[model samples]
Target: MFNTYRLIGAAAALALSTTTLAAVSPQDAAKLGSSLTPFGAEKAGNAAGTIPAWTGGITQPPAAYKTAGQQHPDPFADDKPLFTITKANLAQYQANLTPGQIALFKSYPDTYQMPIYPSRRSGSAPQWVYDNTLKNASSAQLLDGGNGFADAYGGIPFPIPQSGVEALWNHIARYRGSYIVRRASEVAVQRNGAFSLVTSQQEALFKFYDPKGSYADLNNVMFYYLSFAKSPARLAGGAVLVHETLDQVKEPRQAWAYSAGQRRVRRAPNLAYDTPISAADGLRTADDTDMINGSPDRYDWKLLGKKEIYIPYNNYKVSAPGVKYDDLLKVGHLNPALTRNELHRVWVVEGTLKSTARHIYSKRTLFLDEDSWQAAVVDQYDGRGELWRVSLAYLKNFYELPTTWSALDVFHDLQARRYHVQNLDSEESSTVDFSQAIPDDGYFKPAALRRRGTR
Candidate 1:
């Protein structure tokens, strides 16, 4: 493992070049399925063989998962943890731990722990996505200033990314299915571990991945989203609509909110960066929704190169239908016993706030999964340059869809000693329904919000 780490470290230096706006050369693009995984991950394992080579990920659901939106069973349920990292012995594994994770140990030494399981590369996508990814390798080019890209539609825009911003765009454009509807809740856990549930029903139409659609047909729109609050007396009957754009700089995200009291749909331009997410009780920002989103214009992004780190993966237990929120949400962090961690390669990228721009975070370090382009762990620093919060995506393979997505996104406020969690559907009747039929574009418009709102 030590030798392999050294080898990757040396290669990383060579990979971090100055030119980031151009697409990869034809010769480099040819390495896709041969030397690299279909989605741009290194196909071979490290020298120690602890991390296995990429076989075609889990393309089919296990026999246990009988339905599309039902609880997914763990494919590696029989595997056991190799070791556990705790405050007492954290120093031994400090090299593999992120600064945010180390801070968690200092904040809650007794309770915070990570059970490291054997690595599994279980990230997969449909064949069409793979085909498009190969084509994008040589054609996709970053928009002049890096706010977005051009000539990329169905798959990851930059499978062989040349810059930090390019890699970040991969996460933004990664496949999450064409249309999806999920009934979930978000909770802000207080310092003492108390919380209230803010449940909502959310739907999204990923236009970028529409099989019948093309890049020109997108019309600068990436996806259409609509969310309706479903629970708790005070926050119920409200709705939010968003038209997420491919080039946020060309045109910022179009958003509108329907207030239950006023019965009006008003433009919500404040839904962008640094705006506090109401559902999170000011613990997280709107751009922090999917770990990181929105325009990259405010920050100067840099590819910090790749590293082998222990991250939350294959964490099916944490969101199992049988597990109640009361049992999962604990003081300091989620119940460590229910979460699973594994060693995997990730592209580390740092986003430093541009000197001329302003935002809550001074800097952020993101660890993106190599196979799925999912940001698994993110460390956010405050204006004082102190680590303020840690965001973790507990990833699990929805083998029915054959894509790896987060089961729950936990944003931990280190200073406040509170944490906000999104996508808590264990108590709901079903999980994310990717089987939803595509809705008409009119369904996500501002006028639709008014019709859907009921006070």
Candidate 2:
């Protein structure tokens, strides 16, 4: 028995030691301001002048913009498309396009088109965030075989990533605003171009970005999120509260659901992985909420280096309050007229499911914006190695917070000929409120959910 116990302890030690080596060298970390941006993006542009060098990103809101809830005016509203990519001209720009993007033209030759705009490196975070990222570069380490992170706080955890999992960790730990309240609508568009809106009110407090928070105070949690369905009588009053943890392997994500019909709040452990999102009408999985979420333990990740691609960027026009939902939603895809695609460098990472793992997607390829570490595009494949779904995030600079994040996330189902769009606030009375105060710790407790739900 003593010998068996010794063997088990040794195995555990080996696993921990393996993940501790995921840190980059201090010499590479020192390049943040010299050869790399503070967030670790290449400071210099490509040899061609098409993509310009990164000056400091747009840090201030436009003079016309008053407060957080108002619609943000596009800084580059006057700029027109440099060129358009259609089925006729796609081959000319095929080198910079993803396979899924190329397939879109083939699937909808007449309706789908990409308007290529001049690249804008408009993503930026607060000065404190930049400082934290520099610190995290040499300190953060992957824990539990890429399931979590350690020795990091208040920044992109792996700015100078040495592994694909580290790149993913950077996305998972990217800086969003400290706290925000949002009113948005979601739709699962049918093949026939018909859809019903599912409106929701959501709140999030990113403890990782809390000005006063430290690694010790996080309690292994990254953020606190609560979402409530506000429209459609059947789903109204239903709410979900989640405590997203930093070290999920040690303390798994704590989630609770309040059912209006049942008038009760219950533990919701199945909110991760391949579980279908209820509000999405079975169009997206829970893990697909933020393009990539939950644990990275189920797959082997490979870093494919960086490449220039036409990705959705500076998409303020699409999220403008004046643009009604009707004009944005088309039969096959979002109205090309409202979308903006730009040429930018993105880090590519691929994940293949492990033999011991279980997931609907057998493999996934992720393209992360170098400026913001946000997953901009994702291509998911099925067990048979067939492309199943393509996900895109339309990102814009939230100038008030001085941060760049997704204004809208769209998932395209290739086989079903349908799609799901989330985070539409065009018709809402109010958009995002970033000045909201953080709630007390007790507010997110399961018991508190019952009280809030009953009300």
Q: Cα RMSDs of all predictions?
A: 2.2, 7.1
Q: Top lDDT: which candidate number?
A: 1
lDDT of each: 0.89, 0.86
lDDT of 2 at 337: 96
Candidate 2: tens digits of C-alpha lDDT, residues 353-450: 98999999999999899999999999999999999888999999999988889989999988888899999987776678898778887877878877
Q: After aligning candidate 1 to the native by TM-score, how far in Å is the CA of 173 from where it should be? A: 0.8
**Candidate 1: what lDDT?**
0.89
TM-score of each: 0.96, 0.95
Residue 223 in model 1: lDDT: 96
What TM-score would candidate 2 get against the native?
A: 0.95
Candidate 1 lands at a TM-score of 0.96
State the displacement of the C-alpha of residue 420, model 1, in Å, after optimal TM-score superposition. Answer: 0.3
